[model samples]
Target chain A: MKYISEYRDRQVIDRLAGQIASFRDTKAVFMEVCGTHTMSIHRFDIPSLLPAGLRLLSGPGCPVCVTPVGYMDHAIALARQGKHIIATFGDLVRVPGSTSTLEKARAEGADVRTVYSITEALELARTHPGRKVIFLAIGFETTAPATAAGVLQAQKEQLRNFCILSAHKVMPPALEMLASEGVKIDGYLCPGHVSVITGEEIYRFIPRKYGVGCVIAGFEPADILLAILLLLKQVTDGKPRVENAYKRAVRKEGNPKAREMMESVFRPVDTEWRGLGMVKKSGLVLREEFASMDAAGQIRVMVEPPVEPQGCICGQILKGIAAPSDCPLFGKMCHPGNPVGACMVSSEGTCQNAFKFQSDG
Target chain B: MDELIMMAHGSGGKKMHELIRNLFVKYFRNPFLESGGDAAVVPPEPGHIAFTTDSYVVDPLFFPGGDIGKLAVSGTINDLAVSGAAPRYISAGFIIEEGFPVKDLESVVRSMAGTAKQAGVQIVAGDTKVVNKGKCDRLFVNTSGVGIISEKHTHIATADHVKAGDQVIISGYVGDHGMAVLSQREGFPVKTGLKSDCTPLNDLIGKVLERFDHVHFMRDPTRGGVATALCELAEGRQFGVLIKEPAIPVREEVMGLSEMFGFDPLYVPCEGRVLIVADQSVSQGILHTLHGHPDGENAAVIGEITTGNWGKVVLETIAGGRRIIHMLTGEQLPRIC
Candidate 1:
């Protein structure tokens, strides 16, 4: 890979590691805000190699882990009804709802699926016109364009049978909530793919007001190390700034067209985060302009106040105060094959990342 | 004979024969080919035989560059090529639905014939069975090919042949076929500018094989990208594969779509591209020759085989990061979410 390989020089890693060892600032908690980075760190066993005292705490990075209890309940409710086939990404199916997860509902004969793209849900609706194919939409900005595309596509095809129960959330508001939570964060590692579309501008709020250094980085070890080094410089110098370590892909302004598409389709709305309380304007709602594509808009959703299973601290886990292992059900009750929380369901989730890579969780 | 097998035609009998004779044989007539024995006895040859089978269920059966028919034949032949073989003959099997249009079938068959001709292979035999509608996804075609492995060092093992410094070479562009299929399927069809690179690489592989005696192993990164292919090649050898993401060839649209879909193009399937493992010391001349060939024009040394935790593949991403590639346990694209 052109811009990719030269930076992965092992000699560079050793040199950088040596440089970091020379400084040896152990008290700072370098929080990686992106779930991808959290998983990447564990998958590569990065923490073990880091100099002692440089703690890497996972922020509320996993979008799936942050998905509130109500969303899963609503999806499972729709799935169990058997009238509509609930199509969603792999993340949602295993997340525990109030009664059961979508996987359980599916085994009990609900037409639940783990789709790769929202467009695939449109295809299912197109193929099986008789069935109401509702998509269980979730994710941050990077994944929103596809759902937005699905809405436009459904409208174009006049797919009355297809609709979306949206739970897509935005990142900036969530980051603000994290900063508000008083989580000890000396720096922030931004998501690469998200930054590519969102640019590095929206994240300026975090460093300016909060005094935490933020680096928009690619999800690579070298990229991560560079972001950490930048954060370290900020911490040591007592200066707060936003830097772009992944400039090859991410631009300063991000992809305006994609952002426009997303904004045009979805509006900022108050949404419930599983562990994090309902952060205002964190969720994406179908714009009144595209209300017809929204399942929430089309039908009278008599959803009860969302409830969670007893003792599942998915919300606390999302805030980085507790790890997945800290939860009583981490492995015993919340295995990937059987999940008790939404966090354990998605691969990009904190719990799933912990389960798959950080088994200590 | 008896006005014969309708779709009841293929319910296991002579009626099926009549249907085949009238609809299929009438179009695909060949003098040396017939399909009625326990197994067709092919001519014996001195060189080892390279055999491969692929079951294609690609939707939008007819896409920009190819259809299910072309996909079946071309895919199997490509597999043979990656095995250091000169593809010779292919046998196609179609699990078609009953209500399928004769015109559609004609177009598909004609396409298969054209693709077979382009690959320099003959469809020597075939079997057809039609199930009821709503059962099959349009038409599912499975093809198996037999080719002559003429390379003297044909006893290739991805693990056995690879060393710490062995170079990784890709035949050409990656993710073309996967992205092309995705574009049309999602209804955001952009005039279908892309074509499936569903061409056979038998001759191209033969060319590389002739000049390079140190060519360790070759594989078409079909369903699992170069990452999975390398993982398989590195099996039992306890060696790791290091890939430079920038060196991996991916088209702009593919790169954009990958970003949109949150997928690694390296894990997405491709039917045309091949990954070659060769000692890095001996790779310059092979890469030059590959660069000359039209099919391998975009070829580049994406990575190198290394002696490390064997059977592991490390992708040194463009962002100056590394990710150890895991063989995806399941298919790339699922129904929907």
Candidate 2:
């Protein structure tokens, strides 16, 4: 815990809190574009230490929360076919599809399993040679590289039974969409893990085009408080720039090997986000060379048109226009145990994080 | 073929009798079980007795610190000990899958015998059954225990005497047992030197109970970790509990692994730890006594009960902020990053 404990030091955190409070009179709103950041902000109770004028909004950073309903419907349709084994992240098991969820599909005799990584799914394909294994590949750039590696591994092994249902997305195009939509925002608290792979330079366009301050932050209390302090300084000085506050893990050049792996297997395609609709070149699909490893190309199933749940404002919440509390079904009809919306499903989703960790009576 | 267990071993024939005599009775030898009756008959006790049961189905059967056998016995003993009783007798039942190695089964039985002997508890009765392959996870153990509660220690069970100004104490590091098992699970990539804190806590609890009459409540933080245990304690109550985040004791490996997996150490399980609620006057004395024992060497006062915020458990975060501790509603899933 050497590196982690220092970041969580009480003395350092209290001093940063004091410094953040010194700019209490300044008015600004900063958006954090990562699900892990949203979870950390609430887990550390960072908002309690911040000034009232300085507000933090959760953006569409949670990949599970941003995935469109049609995507889940297709996955469920494949699960119902009873010929393939569906491997997915744990949170996706509970995410509600149009008609049923993967959890329900599993209980009713679907071969669905939760894996910690894509490597585990690949191992399943290696062992269960008789059954086809489909990995539900969904996440930001931080996880896309691993899926890409899984694809390359399958190709090398000639594992025809393994394929990926890719729903991977990039961060920069989504940020551009947010700016183009003219959402109110002063600055952005860039994601730490995603920035580690894509590098700090990818966010330079935000400052040049929109004149908004950007600070890449780590997922600790002191790191976030320091990021807020830096953003406040930028707003006061009227100088907007993409600064790397989490230099310990994030580099300006980013991780080249991971980017290379991702580029080899996937190509950009316009995809649908739950709230943001379709953004050009935002999603990743398997390239033509690796098309045989794509689940969509190998399997064909009929799925009904997707339907959104009624009285669910997850769309507005993911867009950072409203809070989870603004929804009427937040705590009453929806909860972590029986989530009614996608935002309430994943532990990192804004609504789920707020419901589980936020200190409100 | 005889090296592995077969269905005939549970058929109540020659194989069944041979397994019972060679495996179970050889290790868990006791007078009550030697009688070979349908029920264990013991002398009548004068004091109130506590009865508790637990089931152990942990995956990977054996890990760095302990196995399912150790977990089953320790879990039952801790349950009775936390209720302010001296655990005296236990009954073990096993449902093992067919084709399991006989040597592995003997190793688990030996572990159980060793742990029970160290705790001075008798395994008075037993039963075994073998199912088809894949019916059970390799094995499952269920243990029921009986313990006698002295008159003076009965107050710990009711917890009615607990009031404001009382202190909360945790015996040792949290999340060791959980992370130890998690790091060694089948599909995980990381391997570490972490060991599970899976040991009997009866000696530690008995010492503290004998020395302090003001110990109002005691509970083992097993599943759902410290946060869930504390939340259950404060639920539907007239008082609130406030705990300092930095004061809680956690190991470096546990903290590191939990951070790596995106799991919170506060919500993981600790097998060999106890949470005590005692009056302010005897809080220091209890800590002093707990620290003297090897199991309680890292004991510390973590929090105190307050007169406000009815039924709420609040934590003073490391950053000088506060958050409510809610009961764990679902499994703690590893984040997708």
Name the best candidate (by lDDT). 2
Candidate 1, DockQ to 2 decimals?
A: 0.07
Give the DockQ (C-alpha) for candidate 2: 0.60
Off by over 4 Å in 1: A1-27, A32-56, A85-182, A189-234, A239-272, A277-317, A321-347, A350-361, B1-19, B26-29, B34-39, B157-159, B189-192, B334-337
RMSD of 1: 6.2
How far residue A213's Cα lies from its native spot in candidate 2, in Å, is: 1.2
Candidate 1 residue-wise lDDT, A1-361, digit = tens: 4554455556676666666665575568877767788766765556644667787877777777787778777788777778898888766666766767787888998988767788778889999999889998888888898888889889989988999999898888888888877987788888887898899899998888898888888865677777777778788889889899999889999999999989889999898877778889989999897777787777655555677877787777778788787999887877766667767676666776666554111
Residue B119, candidate 2: Cα error in Å is 0.8
Clashing pairs in 2: none
- Clashing residue pairs in all predictions, respectively, total 20, 0
TM values, all candidates: 0.76, 0.97
Candidate 2, A10-34: lDDT as tens digits: 8999899899889989999999999
Off by over 4 Å in 2: B333-337
